[model samples]
Target: MSTLLLGVNGQVGHELRRALAVHGALLAPPRTRLDLTDLAAVDDFLHQHQPDTIVNAAAYTAVDKAESETALARRLNTELPDLLARYSADHEAVLVHYSSDYVYPGDGDQPWHEDSPTGPLSIYGQSKLDGDEAIARRGCSHLIFRTSWVYSARGSNFLKTMLRLGGERDSLAIVADQVGAPTPARLIADASVHALRRYREAAELGGLYHLAPRGVTSWHGFACEIFRQARHAGMALAIAPERVSAIASDDYPTPATRPLNSRLELSRLENAFALELPDWQSQLSLTLHDLLP
Candidate 1:
């Protein structure tokens, strides 16, 4: 099967490039060559290439910046997916898309289910939700994985930011109210490959599923764990674990209102695919090993 992976340079896409390659011939075009924002060009490329599987991992991920740059966010997060869904429906190809847990209302403590009522708090979240809806409305064979707090050793994410701050600063403050799993990009890539295999074997497996590592923690808790793992990995840090203060979301204000509850239920994913996802801490430790020198 010919597989076309977009956003190969992104956190999740980078790992997907390797994982998806083993399944089939992978065509991961650079942004300079394939501009997903340009609908005409993307449509032409899809028609010309006619890839059997299209994995869209590209997204405008700047949560705060998205408030001001709504158009750009919509183009990437909403319009691009709509275009891809249309193409997938026309060509009868499978489209694998990644979504965020931010689509749910952030007020609750309960883990979001696949059928949870969505009430996006920020522009970024709304755009992602719109993209998910567009894909579903297209009536195409697709798999939408709603994940949360994604990070990787290679990208600019929370883990990397904390590592840098810990080494340079004497103290740091992290929000403690927000809670979610810090899912590693590697896990997402691996799960995507596994799900793709299942879909190939049985077409009925194509649908929305939450694909995050097990367990949950606050932002402060996640940061503390990152430092703990970094120190265990022999990485030097100026700031001690206790030096990181746990602050409320109000203390660190951003343009976009963040979701306090990002926990997503994974029983659907586990039972459907017969796969066991590791805990958040286990995956975070592995990623820290990769990240630390």
Candidate 2:
């Protein structure tokens, strides 16, 4: 049973390759090898690979910059997956894809469930939501895992940014209004592997699931923890520990509007897969251990 993995260089893709070591053959092409932006190339790759399962972790994740590149972002995020979904349906292959918590407007205090009303605030979010709809409409055997605030030791994420900035400035101001779990990419990959097994076991085990590390935190709180862990690791920093001040989201305006609540409920994942996710603090500690300079 051959499995083809897309976006193997991305954060979740890299970790997924590790988690799915025993799954089967994996085929991930770098951008130079195959540009998913080319719809025909994507279709040809799917047809040639003839994979039993295809995991798409690739996404146009430039949140602020995506405001200007709406068309390209939609092509990569929505159209690419729509093609994959059609292929998977035709070939009878299981398709696994990753999505974002940004699908929700983040206006409410309650955690979002799998069936929540999706109202994306940014072009990035709208593009992802459109892709989700495309996959569902294709009627393929697929699993879509929606996650948020993903960080890894190797990627350009919040943790890395905080550590870099912590070394250059005497003080820092982070948006405190934004709330979500600082989910480690490894956790998302691991859960994907588990869901893959369940997919193989039962044909009916295919749907959208909210996969995130347990607990909730504001951006400021998450940043504070990152710095605290860096300090405990004996890492030097230019910013004083107390200099990390909390500010509202308005302080850091960007091209795309952000959701105030990025939190997602994982009851469906837990109930269906019988998997227990680690606390966000634990996941952060593990990721920081490798990233702190």
Candidate 3:
């Protein structure tokens, strides 16, 4: 059974390529060979490859830009998944998709369950919701993992951005109101493989599950932790020790409104897979080690 992994160049997709290599044939084509924006091209590729499993990691992740690029965002985030789900249903293929917590309303301090009511705040969030809805409505054998605050040792993310800015500036003002776990791309990829194996063992385990680390923290808390770990790792930065200031989400304005609450309940995933996810801080340490020289 061949597996087709999309977004192989992305942070999560890059890690997935390595984590999933031992399973079977992983057909991870680069954008130079396949443009996902083109629905016709994607359909053709699906028909030609006929992969038993389709892992969709590619998405229109430009949250702020997506407000203006509505059509393109819908194409990649909604229509693409719709086509893939239809194909999966017809061909008896399994789909593994990575989704965001932005699909929620971004209110309340309580963690969102897998079956929580969804009310998206932005065009990007709505697009993802549409995609998820399409996948579920198709009734195909699928696994939709909703996660948030994703960062990594590689690629452009909050962790890397803070490291670079901290090294160059004396102080930074980070948004502290928003709260969620900082998920590593490596962890997401690894959990996916584990969940897939468990799904094979119990067919009933096939459905939506929230995927994230155990604990949660605000962006300010995460930045402070990052700085602390960087200093502990002997990395010199221009930012003074504990010089980061906490600011409200309103202070940090963006074209797209960010969800204040991104906390996703992991019991469904942990119970289903019999796994205990590590905390965000510890995961940050591993990613820090890989990132800092």
Candidate 4:
């Protein structure tokens, strides 16, 4: 079987390149060759390659910047996925796509389920929701994994940002109001492979699932843990864990609004695939080891 993986350079895509390679022959094209934004080019390539499975890991992730660049964000987050979904349906191929936790309303403290009602607060979230809806409407064999607080050793994510600021500054303030599991990209990739295997065995296994590591933490708490792990890993940091202060979301205003509640329940995913996800701290520590010396 041949699999086409998009966004190969991204945090999750980078790890997926390794995880998906074991399953079958994989085709991961860089943006220069397979630009998702160019519909005609992407359609032409898909028609020519005709992959059995297409894993779309690419997304418009600039949450704050997306508020201003609405057109670009919509094209990437909504239109592109719609096109891919149609292509998957036409080719009778399995479509595996990544989504965000921002689809849920940011009000409640309860963990969001796959069937939870969605009320996106920002344009980025709305676009993602639209994409998810469009994919479902297309009636293709697809697996949509809604994950949150994703970080990796290689990417410019929250973990790396904290590590950089920790080394340069004596003190830092993180938004404690925002809560979610700090999911590792490696874990997501592994879970995707597991889900793919199950889907191949039973086509009914393809659907929306909340895939996140167990346990939860506020942004401030996550930042504190990062410093602790980095310090234990013999990495130098100017700011101590105790020096990091927790602040409200209002304290740090941005162009786009973020969901205070990003926690996602993973029982549906675990039960379906018979997989036990590790705790967020454990995954974070492992990633820190890779990021540090």
Using all chains and alpha carbons, the TM-scores for the candidates as numbered come to: 0.99, 0.98, 0.98, 0.98
Error of 2 at 100 (Å): 0.7
- How many collisions per candidate? 0, 0, 0, 0
Q: Given candidate 1, what's the lDDT at residue 76? A: 96
**lDDT, candidate 3, 1-293, per-residue tens:** 89999999999999999999998899999889999998999999999999989999999899999999999999999999999899999998989998899999989999999889999999999999999999999999999999898888778999999989999999899999999989999999999989987776677999999999999999999999999999999998899766899999889899999999999899999988999999988899998888765
lDDT of each: 0.94, 0.90, 0.92, 0.92
Per-residue accuracy of model 2 over 68-163 as CA lDDT, tens digit each: 999999998899999999999999998999899989999979999889899999999999999999999999999999999989999799988998
- Steric clash pairs (candidate 1): none
lDDT for 260 (candidate 2): 98
97, model 4: CA deviation in Å?
A: 0.2
Global Cα lDDT for candidate 4? 0.92
Q: Would you give me the overall lDDT of model 2? A: 0.90
- Root-mean-square deviation of Cα positions for candidate 2 versus the true structure, in angstroms: 1.0
lDDT of 1 at 100: 96
Q: Considering summed lDDT, which 10 consecutive residues are worst modelled in model 2? A: 284-293
Best by lDDT: 1
lDDT of 4 by residue, 146-182 (tens): 9998899887999999989999999998999999999
